[model samples]
Target: MFALLFSITIEAKEIEEVVVVGAYVAEDIAEPTEDNILETIQPTKTFMLGGFNGIQLSGTDTKHTGVFKNGVPVNDPSSGWYDFGHDLSTGQKVTVITGANSVRFGSGSMAGVVLLEDNFGRSLFTQIAEDETKAMVEYDYFQIAYYKGTQGSVKSTNTENDWYENKTFKAGYDIFNIELIDYYYEYDTCYDSNFAVSDDCSVEGEKLNVSIDHDRFTLGYTNNKSTHNTGYDMESDRTYADITLVDMLGHELGISGQKETYGERERETYSAYYIWSNDNVSVGYRYEEDEHIVRLGLENDGLRFSVGNSYRLPNLYEQFGDSWVSANPDLLPEQGYGAEIGNDWVSLYYYEFSEGIDFDMNSYSYVNTGSYISKGIRFQNEISLDKGSLFVYSEFTDSDKLRVPDYRTKVSYKYLGFNVEYLGEFDKGADFDGREIDDVNTFNISFSWYPDFATEIKIEVEDLLDNKYEFIPDYNSGGRRLKLSFNTIL
Candidate 1:
């Protein structure tokens, strides 16, 4: 009874103006064109720049949002933060929403959301074997990566130390209705001078999912566990059950419940929703309730809007740690209400002069009565021709004084099957009491090529101007660097 429609619109004419969904375009005409447009639109800094690797370019204290494999909610019971470091292989698509977006999402969506889908193509191994439809007998993929960097500046003496390692594995079995995925990540960093700081972090987790389908209904369960070690060690375990009612007023009704435990803090959430679509509009509402928590959401077309309120209960660390040296024992859980509104649109066919052009934009705002209010804007555009394409984007955030530039502009073009790009970041400086802080600027270029029946090759030169832009205050030293990479499918 629940009907879900998936459709793709193909434009026959040439591309003219390109627009990216949930993205932004900078005001500068000199900005590079090859930059990844997603970075310009989404609120977070984490983005896939072609390879399996993604860059967490900038840091923001906002909640990240992500979608389930089937476009369902992947809610977080504790802090409502979406962990982007997890395995992304299951994701068919990823969209990052920036800033306070309560009006568009719900109460706790003070930061932004990351929407994910599971319909993307298979990995190299899956494609080569041509067996993506059937489960593999054994895990068939593996990869390893390592990185190191340093920093230097004029305002403050400093040293940079950072490193990371990551691994992932996946397998499935049809007989048992089982699928498994495991992920691990480790990172360490040290900064002395300017502002003394040191952090050592590691995270490891696995997810086991099982489902059973019948004539009228479906049932599924998922078990997830993750361990984190930073200044302190913490572990989280979650179990969830989902049910689908096939015949519910010409629509599919879904209900889910989850229980999560972290240290001495425990919480439970229950949610239910109905989805259906016609030729013109798609509509649905989701309702969720738990201890000190209540949320509801509505959706139509490419827009999902929601609102809710929640109360944070004190955790074991906050309720018992020493105040003088350790955690604060008197800390209170954050409580607030929020809402969000958003949408996405694509053109099947438009004017000829605008051939190969696409456009996308999103703007949102949110307020926490007990905390702070925030707003953000993101836009992206792409234009494609016979030779290649061009991309442009921009992002901006406004607080009390618009203290940070946070704005970025980029462009990319392709010719003869080769792609090139340029990127730039705006100056984000603030007048602390009265004195003006120095703002930084940066420029980078990269090229990639693919030959017949061979691997893809890439070369990049960063900080071309050698401008001492401080990604973090006085923590300069990104400096100039050249990088090369090669990728092939077996």
Candidate 2:
């Protein structure tokens, strides 16, 4: 079930012209909206290998995707996974909705579900790029943020050196909402020491998250107590709930649950749902894995369609393992079926999987693999010229053992203050680390100006061909980086 079903927040403003399942809308705030996002996650049947990003839709190898905030269910129950590289959520919105029990915030999305909304009307944000430094503040109901970063190997790749830190706090009233987050990550990776992953590695980690929402319900707690100077040493705790049981005739119902505990294990209960939705359709039932689903979508004359079926299980750190990673509690729960059709430009999809769940980066385990299929096509366009705007996106894939690309493009333009970009990866069949690639291009240029209406300043230039595209094999892909920033509304 290598899935990708990420948005439907309030029927996405009454089905904004549907895309057979929409997403890729980062409205209203800051950055990190994709730049090696598990290999550029812009929908199109994603299947990025290594370093986390999963939902076994096809050649899928794990990380059963399911992310939500402002709707609860935020992965990481020790390792259910969700690491958009420290998830920089500033107006975070990325959508995708492929079906068949794709999502309703239950059963960890079984290979899909991404929704993160923070509703920021702006009130102070700062960024001083290059090596990373950020700040954020919002008053009238509290909000605070800070981030620090260091990446790749400033000391050498095989010599490894990575770093990270993040902190956040939030509060709101009227319908209640509360959140807290903290994390520190440090890593020293290795693999391709000619195969045999894991050779003198070091990892340090810690995380804390607490959430509360209302108007019905959603509560969460996560604490991955850690200290692994060499590997495998973690303490965990995860508890989550989603509730809202009312609204009869017109539908709308809900229920969810989760539980966790690490080490000497034994308290792993995760999955329990019963949901029903309205405006289109969505049905769910999980009652601890006896799973069931029904999903529907529509938009006639202008076209748009969808089909569903999916299921995923196998997390408890992929069945009892983490750190140096390795496990498989008889694993088995990746099932699939899909269909999609598009309109707003183009769209097409296909998925098929059975007892699949790969992820054997050379013995890092988690297999239950076999029978996989993936198909894709996506095209997007937006040309709102008057003064600015001209977006174009692309995707193409065919999957089996997975690592696809027959075309993957992205283009951007913004006029009046510049901002031109382009990305390319054509005919790749194995580039996400299966090796064998052909072209990998990227170009970026930025300029923002704006001195008034709140304030602004910007400058950027990334990889204009500093060529060194490594999407996670031995790290260090920071070929050419330069950034400068300033933002406003304070």
Predictions in order: lDDT: 0.38, 0.57
Per-residue lDDT of candidate 2, residues 154-253 (tens digit) = 2235555455667777665433345565656555544533445553444455556555555456676766665545434677777777666764664556
Question: Which candidate has the highest TM-score of all?
Answer: 1
User: What is the number of backbone collisions in each predicted candidate, taken in the order shown?
Assistant: 54, 14
Q: Per-residue lDDT for 216-258 in model 1, tens only?
A: 3334454556554533444545565556655354455666666
Candidate No. with top lDDT? 2
TM-score of each: 0.57, 0.29
> Deviation in angstroms for 310 in model 1?
9.3
RMSD of each: 12.2, 22.2
The positional error of residue 357 in candidate 2, measured at the CA in angstroms, is 28
| Candidate 1 segments whose C-alpha is farther than 4 A from its true place | 1-61, 64-79, 85-92, 95-113, 117-157, 172-231, 246-250, 275-283, 290-371, 385-387, 400-406, 424-442, 474-477
Model 2 misplaced stretches (Cα beyond 4 Å): 1-37, 43-76, 83-227, 230-232, 235-261, 270-298, 303-379, 382-462, 465-477, 481-490
